[model samples]
Target: MKILVIVPAFNEEEGLVKVAEQFHGINDVDVLIINDCSKDATSEVGRKLGFNVIDLPCNLGIGGAVQTGYKYAYDNGYDIAIQVDGDGQHNPAYIKDLIKPIKEGRADLVIGSRYLKKEGFQSTFLRRVGINYFSNLIYLLQKKRITDPTSGFRACNRRVIELFSARYPNDYPEPESIVYLLRNNYKTEEVPVVMNERFGGESSINSFKSIYYMIKVTLAIVIDNMRKIGLT
Candidate 1:
């Protein structure tokens, strides 16, 4: 299978090399770095490492950056597309575990979750609270449980690649996108994977913005669910 690893980076020059090193000597997998108009040398760093790089004209946030990678995968005829954040929190070593279910035709989307084993960097207490809130919200809407709805470390088959490429959220999208797929009857699964603190750069979401994130994402998911039922 032709697998493409999509790393969406924004001002992550310091951690790009370390992230790339993890993929070294891995045969038959291509990595694409989506530089989301970073102010730093993210694009240059990606090219210097010999990875395919796409530099957007403007910052599109995480959701848009990831959607750009999905579009590239769709156009390039990649069979599987994996999303590993450029922040370096996600471990590329567990990539095999992520794509396994897809290869076996058991799942359309597989999310690498940190809560499954209660291992790795579990994030801040406030962030964990937000994650739990979304988990319950999604379950209430879909009757399905997604332990880590905010996890960006995930893999998808061509079907999901097509879905996301055509229509994706603009901001704070992970939770809403999962619900969108579930409403459409796509199979989603989670596999336990250890994560780490950011290798470099600061997170875009801070304590102050967490509140906005919660409100925006909650509304987006609810509206998406309503749309799926023709209530919007």
Candidate 2:
């Protein structure tokens, strides 16, 4: 039951060391930092902390970086893979619970949701509104509701790792990937978990960028749904 926690890092120098340190103590879990060609010293910080790091040649966005980790997990025969953001928004203390369902053969994907009971790190109003919009969009197509469609903290078993390794959504992937998973009949479960604010650094998406992000992801999800129905 080897577990690989893939940390996608981009310009997250402040949290790199702490994030690695927090997870290093987990039993049977190893940390792999996929540096998305960060402008800051994210890779160097990982190297200095003696953590495994993969430096991408160029920025592949969150989805590509995570796909790299899934590929590594698949090729290296990891039993499970978990995506942990390098920004430290996710707490490692919940790692055991997140992986429990997967370890017990209950689910293929287990997402840590912040809005399960509306507890912990609710994010800003606009972000919450955006998350709700995506949630509704997903429900419209899949007939299932996701409390936190934008949650980056998630775990998946070997089957999902293999599938995602071959293909995955690139830009703004969290929500779109869910559509892909459900469309393919993969089991996805959500667990309510309290998340923390980022350890440091600002978000890549701002108010202005979020508008474009919303439109792009909405289109992506619809297009994915179309593909599932052979409409595309």
Candidate 3:
């Protein structure tokens, strides 16, 4: 199958080159970097590494950047698309694991879960709490347990690509996307994977921003659920 690895980047110049290099020699996988109008040399680094780089004219946040990559994958006839963070947090070795279920036609979407199987790194306490809360909420909504709703390291087949390309959440869409897949009756699963800490560059969301993000994302999920149930 043709696997398109979409790396959504925003000011990820420090790690973009290395990240692209790691995927350069991988078989059956083509890397595409969506440079979200970064102020740094993200696009330049991607080009230097000989990657298929799509430079957006403006910053579109994480959700828009990712959707742009999905649109490209869908238009180009890619059978599978994997979302790999450009921040060096995601390990490319687990790419096969993420695609296994989809390739077997057992799942439409696969998430790389950090909490699966008591191994390697764990998220911050506060972040873990938030993850559990959202996971439970999605379980209640979909009647299926989801352990990792915020994992960006995921793989999807053409069906998911078409869905997100048509309509996707603008900000912090990971949680909401889970709902989207569940609502449409698409099979979703999480595979165990390790995530490294950011290798460089400051995080976009600090403590205050994280708190605000949590509140905003929670409300968005609630509203989306209501809409899905024909209550809103």
Q: Which structure among the candidates has the greatest lDDT? A: 1
- Model 2, residue 80: distance off in Å is 0.6
Candidate RMSDs in Å, in order, are: 0.9, 1.2, 1.4
Best by TM-score: 1
What's the residue-level lDDT of 88 in candidate 1?
Answer: 80
| Model 3 ranges with Cα > 4 A deviation | none
Error of 1 at 99 (Å): 0.7
Q: Against the true structure, what is each candidate's TM-score?
A: 0.97, 0.96, 0.94
Clashing pairs in 1: none
lDDT of each: 0.93, 0.89, 0.86
Question: What is the full ranking by lDDT, best candidate first?
Answer: 1, 2, 3
Off by over 4 Å in 1: none
lDDT of 3 by residue, 1-232 (tens): 8889999998898887568656756878988999989999988888887888999998899999999999999999999999998888888999989999998999999999988884666767777877888899898887888888888899999999988888888877899889878887899999999888776665665677667777898887778778877998
- Tens digit of lDDT per residue, candidate 1, span 138-159? 9999999999999999999999
Q: Give the TM-score of candidate 3.
A: 0.94
